[model samples]
Target: MSVSSSLTGRTLIVMPAFNEEEAVGNVVREVKKTLPGTVVLVVDDGSRDATSAVAREAGALVATLPFNLGVGGAMRVGFRYALENGFDNVVQVDSDGQHDPAGVPALLEALDSADLVMGARFAGEGDYRVRGPRQWAMKVFATILSRTSRTRLTDTTSGFRASGPRAVALFAEHYPAEYLGDTIEALVIASRSGLVIRQIPVAMRPRAGGVPSHNPFKAAAYLGRASMALVFAFIRPKSIYRTGSNA
Candidate 1:
């Protein structure tokens, strides 16, 4: 796809941060450096630290939640922000710095043909590795989601993704807020809603700071929860989040 300069100019970059003060400031700056004048909003997900201040210090618009609400919750606020602010695209980037801002333009360019475009970590560009039960769960989830979306997806749980106009409008109303729902179950919602989904190769980076959300010991439990999230997503009624127009 040919990338248009206007595509990135009008896009909204939503970085969901939870106690990521250590890296968010520099991440925000990096985004500004890479994207150059694109609007970057940092949704401070109820961190006890000065995440909001740090983000603002780095020249990003900040929205603070009263309490922690995970990535899904923070992203919902972002979608609504984009909807209200005239942005036709919403890109979710992690503020902990696992996602490179430089990959964002490719995601937006993909919107020319897809309503949702994911920056895939396992699509032959990144050396990012996952193992054990978590890896098992990811492969299973990817296989199922690939079939459901009718498009192959190598990284079903990647946090780096962009939503086009259709996805932005739909997700603003229906985006999930549950554990593991943001990426995995969220794609299920988009698929069931008849949105086009696709992905492109992108490099993943080491976390700039903050604790990892999961670890090896939690792998078994993660597999179970991940399966449940996918199941619950498929079973949800369309009317729960759709109007006739969006449906």
Candidate 2:
């Protein structure tokens, strides 16, 4: 689906960038090409590099943070922008060029019914290559989250995702402020809120330049911490969805 035809309401592509000056421009350019009418927002997470300038030159709206905010914090800023600006949809893609811009159409298509559309590298029919250990960890984490949420989720750690207005509001209101665990937390929150979550297969590439933020040991630790966090969130007797006045 072409961006113009698929999206009647406004859509914003939010790129949380940290020192990705090398790839930020290209990523923004590709997103513009794929989703012509969509606005692009690059949340600069206090990078010492030229990531913000490059993104601006590429025609993306740059939101610069004074200091380093992790991925979740950056995304929260983007989500708040989307909400305050009245965007109907928000799509998040990494600035490292690991996520293919071409697959954005698949996500937009899946958003037809779902409140959130997630790209699953493992479940989709595509050439997805990940380190063996990281792949195993993702699978295990997905299994645990699915059982805990009472909803099957194929990719709980995927950063490539699209969110509709409801999700935008949800995230803007209650997004986790630290780390990269918001992907799974969003899913669990959506399920509990009775919002529909869908997944599609999208091709993924290996990191284009620097190594991933998490190494094997770090990935394991993040997985463990994220699992515990999800369990705690699920057990807490609180609804992420607000009541009538707030909604």
- Local accuracy of candidate 2 as per-residue lDDT tens digits, 144-210: 7677556577788889999888888888877666454477666776677767887788778877664
- The alpha-carbon root-mean-square deviation between model 2 and the true structure, to one decimal in Å, is 2.5
lDDT of each: 0.90, 0.79
Give the lowest summed-lDDT range of ten residues in model 2.
238-247
Alpha carbon deviation, residue 216, candidate 1 (Å): 2.2
TM-score, structure 1 vs. true:
0.95
Summarize candidate 1's per-residue lDDT along 1-247 as a digit string, tens digits.
3346587677999999999999999999998888876889999999999899999999999999999999999999999999989999999888989898888878987889999999998999969988988888889989999999999998899989999999998888788899999999899989888999999999989989998888767877998898899999988886666733453
Clashes of 2: 0
lDDT of 2: 0.79
Q: Candidate 1: minimum summed lDDT over ten consecutive residues — where? A: 238-247
TM for every model, in the order presented, reads 0.95, 0.89
